[model samples]
Structure formats: structure tokens, C-alpha cells
Target chain A: MSSSEDSMCRAAVDEALQTVGGKWSYDVISRLYYGPQRFNQLRRALGGITVKSLTDALRQLERQGVVHREVIPTYPVNVEYSLTEKGRDFRAVLFQMRAWGEKWLPGEKDEKAEG
Target chain B: MSSSEDSMCRAAVDEALQTVGGKWSYDVISRLYYGPQRFNQLRRALGGITVKSLTDALRQLERQGVVHREVIPTYPVNVEYSLTEKGRDFRAVLFQMRAWGEKWLPGEKDEKAEG
Candidate 1:
């Protein structure tokens, strides 16, 4: 790539990272990728995440149009969260990261061998 | 993917992020993607980075085996930095990120339009 193109790519990558680079962002998104879930369900699925952290991550993702939040009226109002179309599209990046990680970063088996 | 598989992927992705997710890590790696460079050259290429930040980033990457550092034996010792084979392989993740960013994130043109 030309210098200008390289810079542009860098900026774009930075922007993407900024949007989804939070500590809990990937976990939240990955869970939602399976399907939508009630807020409580999501909270339960992501063990060890504080309520505040999950809330912040969901709100930030919603604001960025990467996540959708819906309120269902019932005896007790039910809130559901899911990946938006944009969020679903982000799977490519996640998949790529996973692939690279699998190749370069040692997994449990590799660690055992090393030990 | 199965739940077990998803969890494994998450672990791998997390490991990858932990290795390259530093504030300056991606910027440093992206700059080196083009080619190797001297310390000062890299520092200048990545404007706004403090010397300490660069030093820390390079050291961290080197420790992770993503970057290789070499010292030239000469009248004045010169140091050079380049990506390892593993680092070069990480371009796929970066490219995927760039594509996602281009699709979703607002660039300068988009910002101007909104303004």
C-alpha cells in the first residue's frame, strides 16, 4: 500500500479497536453472536464480569450501533440485547483474531507440552 | 460453534489481545509491517509517541516474540527492529480490522458530512 493508504488503514483499524476494544466488549459480543439474550441471561453467561462493566460495555456497543437493545413489555419489563447487523459483520475481524491467536499463541495442549 | 469451542476461541482471542492490545502496541506493529527501521526512524514515523512509550512497546513486543531486535556492530552501535514470522502473520487480523473499520466507522469524510 502507498503511504497514504497505509495511514488510512491504520486509522480505520484504530477506530475499530476503539469501538470494540473494551475489556468486556469481545466477550459480550461473542455471547450475543450465538443469539440475543435477556440482560440477566447475558450477565449470567459472562462469569466474573461486574454489573457495571457489562452495563457500560453494552451501552457503549449500543451507542456505536454494534448492539441493539429492546424492551419487551410484560408483567416485568424484559430487556434483550443482540448483535446489530454491524455487530454481526464484525465477526470477520473476530474470526481473524481467533485464527491468528490459535496459530501463534500456545493453547492448553501446547502449554502442557512445554511444561 | 459449540459452547466449548466458543470458549476456547475466546481464550485464544484474549491471549492475542493481551499480547498486542497495549496502547502503542498496534501502532508500533503496524508501522513495522511496512519494513524494519531504526529506533529513531520508528519513533519519528509514529509521531506523538513518547520515547518511554516506544521503548516499552518494543520491549513488550520483543518479549512476546512478535518483534525481533538486532544490534549492529559498527563504529557506533545501531539498533534495528522488525517483525518476526509470527508478527508478519498477524497482518490478517489487522487487515480484517481495517475492513471492519472502513465499513462501520465514520472517517474524515463521514465526519465532515455529519458536521
Candidate 2:
């Protein structure tokens, strides 16, 4: 790529990283990728994540239009979190990265080999 | 995907993120993607990155087997860093993310819209 194109690519990647680059941001999105889940359910899904951090990550994703939060009022109030269309589309990036990780990263197989 | 598959995917992603998730790791790798560069050239390419942090990031990548470091014995000794085949394969992930960023991310066009 030309210098200009290279810079543009760099900027885009920078912005992309800014959006999903947090320690838990991409992982949180991956959890929601399966389907909508309650706040507590999401917390349960992502162990080792403090409630405050997960809340912040979800809110950040929501602000970026990558996640949607729905409130349901019943005898007991309910809130569900799911990916927006844009968020669903964002999965393509994660999917590619995950595939690359599986191939290059030391996974279960590697762990088994060493252990 | 099944529950077992989900966890596997998550592990893969977690490992992937660990490999490239640092604030400057991905950016550093991206700089090297164009071609091999001496330490200083890479430092120049990535503005605002501290020398120590870049060195640490490169060392981490080298440990992961993604980056190859070579020392040249010339009148002035020099060291060059290049991506191994595995590292080259990792670019596909960055390429996909870049494409997603340009589309969903607030880029030059978005900046112009605001300014």
C-alpha cells in the first residue's frame, strides 16, 4: 500500500482497537455473540471479571452501537444484552482473529502436549 | 455452536488476545508487516511508544515465535526484525479488523463530518 493508504489503515486499526481493545471488551462481545443474556448471566459467563469492569465494558460497547441493552418490566425487572446488527457484523473480525489464534496460539492440544 | 465449542472458541480468542492484545503490540506488529526494520525504524514508525515498551513487545512476540530477529555483522552491526510465516499469517486477522474498522469505525470521513 501507498503511504497514504498505509496511514489510513493504521488509523482505522487504531480506532478499531480503541473500540474493542480493552482487556475484557472483545471477550465480553464474544460471550454476547452466542445470544442475549441477562446481566448476571453475562457476569457468570465471564468469570474473573469484576462486575464494575463488565458493566463498563458493556456500556462502552452499547455506546459504540455494537451492543443493545433492553429493559423488561415484570414482577421482577429484566434486562437483556445482545449484539446489534453492527455488533453482529463485528464478529467477522473476531472470528478471523480466533481462527488465527487457534492455529498460531498454543491451545488445548499444545497444553496437553506439554502437560 | 455447542457449549463445549463455545468454551473452546473463547479459549482460542483469549489466547489470541493475549498474543496481540497489548496497547502497542498489534501496532508494532503492523509496522513490521510492511517489511523488516531495525529497532529504530520501528520506533519511528510507531509514534508515542516508549523505547522500553517496544523492546518488551518485540521480545514477547519473539518468544511467541511470530517475529524473527536477526543480527547482521557489518561495519556497523545491525539487527532487523521480520515476521515469520506464522506472523505473516497473523496479518489476515489484522487485515480483517482493518476492513471492519474503516467501515464501522469513525475514520477520516467521520472526523471530517464532525469538524
Best by TM-score: 1
lDDT for each residue of candidate 2 in B20-79, tens digit (9 for 90 to 100): 766677877888878999999998887778989999999988987788999999769999
Looking at model 2, residue A82 earns an lDDT score of 95
Q: Taking the tens digit of each residue's C-alpha lDDT, what string does model 1 give over A35-66? A: 99998898899888888999999999998788
- Per-residue lDDT of candidate 2, residues A54-74 (tens digit): 889999989877899999986
lDDT against true structure, model 1: 0.85
In CAPRI terms, model 2 is classed as medium
Report DockQ per prediction, comma-separated. 0.70, 0.62
Summed over model 2, clashes come to 0
After superposing candidate 2 on the true structure, give the runs of residues whose Cα lies further than 4 Å from its correct spot: A2-4, A47-50, A107-115, B2-4, B47-50, B107-115
Candidate 1's interface RMSD, please?
A: 1.3
Q: What TM-score does the first chain of candidate 1 have?
A: 0.86
